[model samples]
Target: MSLREVIAQMRQTMASLGGEAAVLLQRLAARAIRGELRRLAGAGSRVWTPAAARAVVDRLRRMLVRLVAQLGAALGKALTSAAATSLADAALFFETGDRALLGHVLPLRPVAPTPAQIALAREGVFKASLGRFGALLVHAVEGAAVATVLLGKPHRAGVDHVALALRRTAAAHAWELQRIAETEASAAYNAAQLEVLLAQDVPGDRMMKRLVATFDSRTGRDSVLLHGQVRPVREPFFDSHRGHFYMAPPNRPNDRELMVGHRPAWGEVVVDRWPVAEDRRAAPAPAATRRVPGQAIRSAKNLRAGDVLAAPGRPRIASVAERGGRIEVRTEQGLLLYFAAGAAIGVLAAS
Candidate 1:
């Protein structure tokens, strides 16, 4: 076949492919959005009533709008690159009259971003993060209000105080809160997908679940645990200031399960259980007492079998039984404590 004829044939093929690509992209976008909405509905139903579910969807849609707006430039550049490649191929067919010449013009690759370009991209992501944080703050406030109405029957005053404190604390650490949002945004950018930003399984989602569970517990409402949902109570929950709170089983005095709070800065989740004298007596000594020269356990990964570790606000010491990505600590009462990877653990005695 003549080179001119081959070039003409290739141009026709490219034109057909381009049309198909556009249709595919549009379909993919539609499916992605619908799938996202369904996922949000499922997650929202776990913690919210039907009316509240609509609010969750609304908040998520706003966040998605903000993300799309901030990412406009990036998306535009991608589209431009695609269009340029197509134009280059068409131009090559006219000039060279050879199919092989298409590679010279098209290069088969997009131009890489320079350092300045990367900086600009990061700045856009940061702005998106700020928007996300705003949405999260608003959601938190709304959730608190809903919780107060649902759980504040007997202890209305206490619920009101908690709601106020949550809002105030979020406001107080506005900078830190934005930082968290930026981190999440950056991660989503690196993944090159808006789905990460819109996903219902993010940390903020988990925090909302925790808020719902905490409210239910406080209000004496029975909560149905979702399958495979690891309760946050297993790990030491920290506030913005890093003050740790641990969950405790019902004790003799109160006979009510407690989410014990410590350190006044974060405000306290007032529970019926008070610190009993026996609790202090039962607690293992601080890690500093067991530190041997140059053998101090610094990270959760360093834990080994036979090491006694102190859990925050828990009286009984747990002995480290296994160590790997996750560390397992078992108390004398056969209670198994599972620490996720990178979870901070206080070493009471290094063995």
Candidate 2:
């Protein structure tokens, strides 16, 4: 098919999803405008008037228009280049203010990758490097072998280090790609979104009104107990900065158990647990151990494997083990709280 036809079809496909995007984008605009109006009225008034509602509705209408234009421009650019295909697909699919599209069309944005996200992204970079560089290495090795045999050249009988060079180059490339992806996928868009909001004379922080997340996920012993099964989101995911926080497990940042502070843009019940609010009430300030009071210990000297311990506001230390020359306290919540020798830790009594 002609490139023109491809672009046309792409535009049509985007249009079909435009309704969904419109609903989300318009809601976002209404929120931003309402936030501005509220602030302009001074003294944090909680009042809502019909006039204000109309104003928000009007902004919503404008948002739909902006979305259409954004789609047209973005699709055009994405198809025009090969590298941008991923970003285009990403931006189109999300249809939320959270998307870090280079276009910077919407306002509300959460903070970028948590440490967990960074790790996952690095993994992605490494995988991408393996696929691209691994193949190149095979061909290069074959070429070198062929050249050596064909030329009747003396076997260098030395460590050529070609593989090492490629490996190091791959590592460098992986790092650079990861850094680029983080910025393009998150930081740049977040900053641009906030910039646009501020330039439009709105209170950027306040208009970032929604902190999505719900009662979900198996937050290890370290997190707040959700109901008997789950709990509300307010205490766990919501963040004063970037609107919400995302937590990934400390061990390794994988996509499966991401902790995010936001909800779905369209308000659907999520089946995927990839992004959750594993607030775990986030280690509730580690005070006294309610389960076994006065058991808190000061040093790792007495800790031993298979020793069960308890601490207030923390999950019971399910077990103690030596790891990396330190005492690793494995919490019931699946957290690895490491204590160094002679370090002061909360009271801990063998459970």
Candidate 3:
């Protein structure tokens, strides 16, 4: 084939590989996430348990390992005419921990082609499918690269006819193969990261409460999960901790995750059906049931510095507050709250 046509064919090969590899990597990550979620749901816990939480992180690490091998194999096939590339042997690993997510892709010194890549060189150069006659130029100039480094000899005695006018097509092809491999792996890794972000903001405040409960209070994981959810959320959200985007019960601005399965209308006119607490469901759980017997909570004005305080809906946590001038809430984290005076803050127990 004419050199122009051969170069055009190689370019076509690269463009095709980019599209196929991008789709493949994206699909692999999404499928793996779905599989993990389905498996978690099947495990039969109404809640996302501690084991499931750890598994979520662990699964990401495992996914990376599989991604590397699959990407390697895919690149191998694409770069090949009749022989495979050693892209799969690129060797990638992950070092993930509680607060650490690290991945390693071994350095590629492709100047010295591996056994498989050498075969690839032979196929591309001698076979004339991709490298064509032009590729003979570089190998001859660069100390006979294709023969010595790739073929393990000075030159192919009779087969390699070194034409001075030829270009360095084989070396360029090998470099392109390495670049494609790197790009594909990166796309897959980015997809997995998105999955983790979605997991952190996993759509239910109740579920998230249970998830954070699994860790000790000292760990402060509730905030961590909340912070990680920022990237995935499109519409206005209540809080990262709750992960509910549609409508927050308390004074929360809302949209997004709450309306799951609906096309994301980033700034849609999603005003709530009723005024904030006008909906019975939005109202706080009854104080009678939440309160301990004989411990009626007084107005914020009458409460003292050491008084126990609780919000209307949440009864599990009791905060020892400085004073409830406006608002004071003891959530999963027992931090002292300071609210504006006359803000209709907390319900305090009579001393």
Candidate 4:
């Protein structure tokens, strides 16, 4: 058939499709041009070599496949599956050699989940990792190849889809293992705290307050004060700082007076020596200056979110309202807290 006929046929076929017809036509047009160039080069004295034409066609085909795969993967898992055949057909359009053909297989993307879906996914990941690790460890000792592959980092496969899947599976296992370790660690922590509380000479209410405070210190309660001497102990995965307090967590250098005067409303929850607030408003304090939006505040020079903030001799954070210029903040266990300029002291306008 004539080149014009081929071009006309391609145009008619492309016009029939909706949406992505333009992109598809472009690919077809590229293939046609490559073929035409191959024909023209052999005609004149300055004729192109067969190998050169074949190479050009091959490179164009590889580029076209890469473009399609990148775009299709973003459309979600269902589109990837549905367009699998079309993707394969597009790959075969400009077949000049085996090497280019080999590179056209598209990688599929995993479907994203909602927050609840992610939680469920994480649970499933944990179960799968636990099951795989338990079952495979025994085989690893016996020199099973499968065991090695499962434990190893991601590897490339003939198809990009296979490699992508393996990477995701490995990631899931790592995350689940981390979560399991944290749960076991938390259980051990609670048992130790229980023993400490029972042995203390303080009243039951006071002992409970101390326990809550200790828990807060070890968790993400960076703003809590350590009234006495608190020192770092064993490192905890979740805590930025780990320490035990003899008295109370220290207040920030500038906010010490305000925190010392304000009493905790319902005491605090303890991680190690830090005290987490039961409710910001549980024990009422005077209305304070509200931070303005978009204001930039400098972080404590020496302290970080996980560092143990302690008073002179305390092992945990003290239940103080304001120490120095910084507000004492106590957070609940397992919650990730992000501190910003306006969010530091949670004293909202009393309604």
**Per-model tally of clashing residue pairs:** 0, 19, 2, 61
Per-model TM values vs. the true structure:
0.22, 0.22, 0.24, 0.22
Candidate maximizing lDDT = 1
lDDT of 3 by residue, 263-306 (tens): 12212212221111112333233222344564554444444544
Q: Rank the candidates by lDDT, best first.
A: 1, 2, 3, 4
Query: How well is each residue in 158-208 modelled by candidate 4, as lDDT tens digits?
Result: 112222333344334443333333332222222222223233323322322
Better of 1 and 3 by lDDT: 1
lDDT of 2 by residue, 1-351 (tens): 322233233333333332333343334434543454343334233223334333433443354345334433332232223112323432333343234323234433433433233333334433453245334434443343333333332222111222233234434444333332222223222222222223323332222111112223432322221111111222222111111233221111111121222223324323232223334344334334333355555456566544444443435556777654555555566655545444444444453
Which parts of model 1 are misplaced by more than 4 Å? Answer: 1-7, 10-17, 27-31, 43-54, 63-78, 97-351
TM-score of candidate 3 against the unseen true structure: 0.24
Clashing pairs in 3: 245-255, 326-345
What does the lDDT read for residue 172 in candidate 1?
A: 60
Q: List runs of model 4 lying over 4 Å from the truth.
A: 1-168, 171-173, 199-343
Cα deviation at 17, candidate 1, in Å, is 5.0
**lDDT of candidate 2 at residue 5, scale 0 to 100:** 34
Give me candidate 2's TM-score against the actual structure: 0.22
Error of 3 at 222 (Å): 47
